[model samples]
Target: MECCAFCPTESRELYKCPKCDRLYCSLKCYRNEKHWICSESFYKDQVKEHKPELMENEPQPEDSSSKNFNPEMFEDYMKTFKKDTRSEKEKNPQIRVRADEDILFDSDDEPDYVRVVAEKSLEEFEKIDMNDLDRKLTMAGLGGLTDNDEQLEYLYSQLNDEEKKMFNRLADNLQYDEMGLMNSVFGKNLPKKK
Candidate 1:
């Protein structure tokens, strides 16, 4: 049997989330899944508007001309943004907003299953943040290094032998032709488009 989405060690009896229909071993995983997927999935399904098909006679993928050619018909896709008259609750929210009834303030000594699952997710996020933070802090001292070679030297010295091999592979592309990339951005210092 497939393990629960949240708990891998548990496989006995799993409950399915009503919104997205994801399986969970414990009620806590089911609860946590609510904040992450359930609530959004429920409302999203309810309010989803069916869009009409684009075209019946659309060109096939294998046709080369259809792929390369741009339609000359349209000046712009839209003249103005359509005004969304729906209230805040009707619209897709930026962040997940749980209904008041969904939230349970259970006050027991030990952390509940939902709290454990949420904490685990939080710890993983924090670990990613710290690693990125460390890299930024190290890069912040780059100006103090005299040149690009010196900066590379500092970075290489900081790496282990295993990481040094990866670093060398990354640096391999440093000498490749950059003319196309440079042209795309600077555009051969082209004349201004009127």
Candidate 2:
């Protein structure tokens, strides 16, 4: 919800200045002198803070004869640090590709091969008879094992009116997350899944 730092009017669309790290709503605000008064000051402060004497030098190549010559064999084996990562323009050059207008066009729909196969598969599943499906379930050793809440609902549907009232009453009394207390109607040890 933070607005652009340059303008009085609120706006979500903001561009962060690379040098000063300040937000501006538009390119016009980016170039505005009133908004950029401290940018030069920031840059100057940065340079002053990072003076020549304070700068840390990159590790110089060790002399083989120097007494402090720790065996850099481990370092070389691990490649722990990059001795020289700068001057990267001299390393790999950039790749450039020209934009082609002819290659840019929108399709109304995707190529329908996946869609057709999915539809046919769904139709085949729908065509399966319940008796065959039940037989498959029995063969798979899942005849007694019902699916989650859906099978619980199906089991509830098979109860008579009076039994359903008792079931609803018990269900209402029991907490789903933590059944802290056993329902007295169902006795002290309730039928709980192992």
lDDT of 1: 0.57
Whole-model Cα lDDT of every candidate shown, in order: 0.57, 0.62
Q: Where in model 2 is the C-alpha error above 4 Å?
A: 1-110, 144-194
- How many residue-pair clashes does candidate 2 contain? 0
Model 1 agreement with the true structure over 95-187: per-residue lDDT tens digits: 455675332334433357768878899998877865566567668863555468988788789999999887676555453334334346667
lDDT of 1 at 82: 44
> How does model 1 score by TM-score?
0.23
Model 1 residue 104 distance off true place after TM-score fit, in angstroms = 44
lDDT accuracy of residue 187 in candidate 1:
70
Question: Which pairs of residues have clashing backbones in candidate 2?
Answer: none
Native-to-model Cα distance after best TM-score fit, residue 159 in candidate 2, in Å = 25
